[model samples]
Target: MKFYISTLGEFDIKVDGQSILRDSNRMYRIYKLFEYFLTFRNKKLLPETIIDNLLSDSESEDPKNMLRTQIFRLRKIINALIPKGELPEKYMNLNFTNGYYCLEIGENTIVDIDVFENLIQKGDKEREYDIESAIESYQNAISLYKGLYLSDNAYEVWLVPTRNYYQRLFLKTLNKYIDLLKRNEENEKIVNLCEKSLLIEPFEESIHIELIEALLKIGQNKSAMQHYEYALNMLEKELDAKPSAKFINYINIIQNYTSRNNDLDIEAINKSLEEELPEGAMYCSLEYFKFLFNLQKRKSKRNNEYDYLLSIMINSNNNKSINDVFSVLKKSLRKGDVFTSWNDNQILVMLHNVKENGTETIKERLTDNLINYTRINRNEIRLIFQPVSMENTIL
Candidate 1:
């Protein structure tokens, strides 16, 4: 029988054709992680590494022990859910060998992410470049985006890059789709498609800009301006930045063709108001951005002005990405904003009264916890340090 893991996107998961995993979203994610092991059963993929990446930073318990418990839990449920012969095929896929879990799976059976990626590769490679065939492939790929790719689970550290790649690809295909519409002179269709693309990747500039342009081309300047303003607000609020000169210029150029500045009210052209920004960075209101600094102690405050400022800098950085590089701060962060890191040798501490502790006390607790953690895992690897301070930061 063919193996398939059913992901309800950010929702729960199902195994094979049964409800092995339930309404519990995180456990459902854990089950999805096993798919990687099932797919690549030939190599020993360490359970500890998987745990480090899969569990939240708040989850600091020994995963080697946790793995055994989780496995027991999974086996009981899976064995009950799956049929006899099918059970062996699924369970055998996860091999406990040489002190770790190994994975191996046959080629191309992955869900629609691979399907679209393969199609994109094929379409790009063809001399004639069959847009129609490519569109069909993209349609298939689009069908598979059940919501977000692996959205509900924590899998591995390296998997974040892979996951981001697919998210980017999903947005990329929308642009290609719009071009196909443009070639066919289907201008009205572009607006709806652009709107759909924006929902998945609201931060992507191209679609945001395109949505406005498509509106303008169809004599919908009012609607165009609305979308343009909305896009502007999203970027500025999220990143503390403004739009690029190109987007402003395009909107300005379109408005210039109009009788009145009803939508984009400006005395002069946006080109004159053009901003210098790094590629992929937007412009925003610097004055409105709030940096939440720590309440410092009066005694130590005299010497640690630099530290206080660094903490503010870290708060400024909170506006950078969707969440963070790892996901620790992301879950803890309110509104899930893109915040900066405290440029300190951080530690992952499981505390009894984290809310009551002072900053330095908490920081010391973290440092001690981290040192002990490293000592326990020292046999696996050497020391690694990421010092977060104002002097060494980019954001």
Candidate 2:
């Protein structure tokens, strides 16, 4: 009998290459219990710890009895899937000894997560000496991580630490692999790997930077800028933060790659003339927004005044139009504040002379007003603040 367990993305169990878990007749709790034991395999877990970890917030008062019942059911499920008389009494059984429960793995059992960790360990060791073998190992390991560990177990506190650990490891391995590829000047391979990596880690700003650089190296400037815009919008909306200084500088370098204009004043004057000047909360194009952003940078430098940029985005699932949200913003912002459309789904507001604390007040008031006036859910709106510094430039 062969038992294979997969805990990434979905929790699945296969016996003799046949899936035993089904959608309509799913045993969610039993599966979760089995997963918990498998996760802490070979460890002595107290009944209280298992109950707290697996059955927390439940209405059941007799958790120990409940756990015993579930364990019995899990064993039944496992036995039904496997051939009779295949293993000894101890093998392929959830065992209890000395008031501790453990999943006693049989010799034939293979867990995807276990294989994944082993491959990662192998890749790390081989990466020191053999690049190709390490890359292969990493690729195999990453493929097994189809998505987050037990993605269906989102909000399960016990899973968070392990999930985060694997996610970080995956990213570290990916970055190392990309670096090795870069050493070989494998630009196309870099592009493929980065795109695949972004599927698993879309919000990884470092990967976005690498993707942009890889695209640029292959004369894909248009694609690179599109990805930059995406990274900027995503980071701002999701994290309320900007890309790192290195990422911003790299973008600037890409833009000015062929420029011969060493004169700063001439470039500044030209840029200023090209921007659509806004007195207060006026709508403008993204291009104009960039120009105004630079203008604000200069102003902050000259007057040593603190300012902040706030981005408002309407969730696509909402029925509110861009103009509808813009109307609310125009009425809500102060007279010195300038606003522009960053994208069809996003609005950029430069809140002038306001400290970080002031931005909080503004956000609160804006949230209240928008909720009071609009039929949209509060979650359908996203507001991101970009703090300004004279020493740095932002887009």
Candidate 3:
């Protein structure tokens, strides 16, 4: 009988194509003991090491005896996994010899973690001389990693380092495979691979950047922009930090892709530039807002226009409240006004054709709008305005 074992993403064992491990039959100590033995299979493990690693949290008066009892139970489970006609010793063995416990499996046994590491090693060896071969090996290895290693045992202290090692190896393999795909200009494949990789590693900024780059290459400009926005929002909301400069650079790349047009006719250019009439205030990225702010500042100076910069600060710790405040701003301000998030807790707006006296009226309107549209208290929302002509500081 052949044994099939899987420890990545989940822990499972199958004998002769039949699953032997089930949740219904799972006992805490028995399952953990079996998992520990399988993880360190064929290695000498002292009783002291086993008890200290697995039973340290529990109070055991006789830990050595407890370890022996658990090992006996594990041996019974392994024996049951053997086929009815085959000898149990031929399939698997659990033994204590030379003052060390060891679990040994037959040569016919297949373990996914062993195969995963082997494929990665094969890819590393082939990468220098045979690019296509290396890519294939890396792709196979990456596919084997369904999720974090032994995710079912996530809370186990002994599993953390090993789990992290496998995860990092998976990322490295994925990046290498992506690099080779890039060399071949297989952008669509990169897009698919990076998208799947992101589901596994959503907080991975590099994968997001790669996904955006591939989308741009394939002329999916709108999707690229949407992903960029999503990534930015995810980083800010989840990590409570802005994306790295490498990620931010994608904005310029996306803009360049979208703006590239061969049409030289003036009418066509104007048609391309034409956009729908604004319904309410316009919202933009902080980067774009800086550009608009500077242009508006120069225009106000030359034309002596009444332009005011409004800063709205939300004091609440809730992200939902901050989002609601932005929603209120969009509906309350005029179409000519523009705004952007200044930070996690603040928003900046450029109000056109508004004077110092008019600022008070606008502030009152915003205050009322916030109260009407958002659950945020009046005291939680603060608004301040300064004329564009008087502002010389950079964003």
Number of colliding residue pairs in each model: 21, 0, 0
lDDT of 2: 0.73
TM agreement with the true structure for every prediction:
0.55, 0.64, 0.66
Model 2 C-alpha lDDT per residue in residues 159-200, reported as the tens digit of each score: 888899888888887887788788789989888777766666
TM-score of 2: 0.64
Model 3, position 292, has a per-residue lDDT of 55
lDDT rank, highest first?
Answer: 3, 2, 1
Better of 2 and 3 by lDDT: 3
Candidate 3: segments with Cα more than 4 A from true spot: 15-18, 85-90, 260-395
How high is the lDDT of residue 91 in model 2?
43
The CA lDDT at 27 in model 3 is 74
Q: Which pairs clash in the backbone of model 3?
A: none
Error of 2 at 94 (Å): 0.8
Across 1-395, the per-residue lDDT of candidate 3 in tens digits comes to 57888887777787766778766645767988878888788899999998889988778788888888888888887777777878655667888899998888777678888999999999999989999999999999989887788777768888888889999999988999999999999999998888777656677898888988898889776567656765665465456687888887777776666567424555644543342123477677786567556655655664577888989988987769878887777789876678888889889998887865898899899999888888878899898888887866546
Of 1 and 3, the candidate ranking higher by TM-score:
3
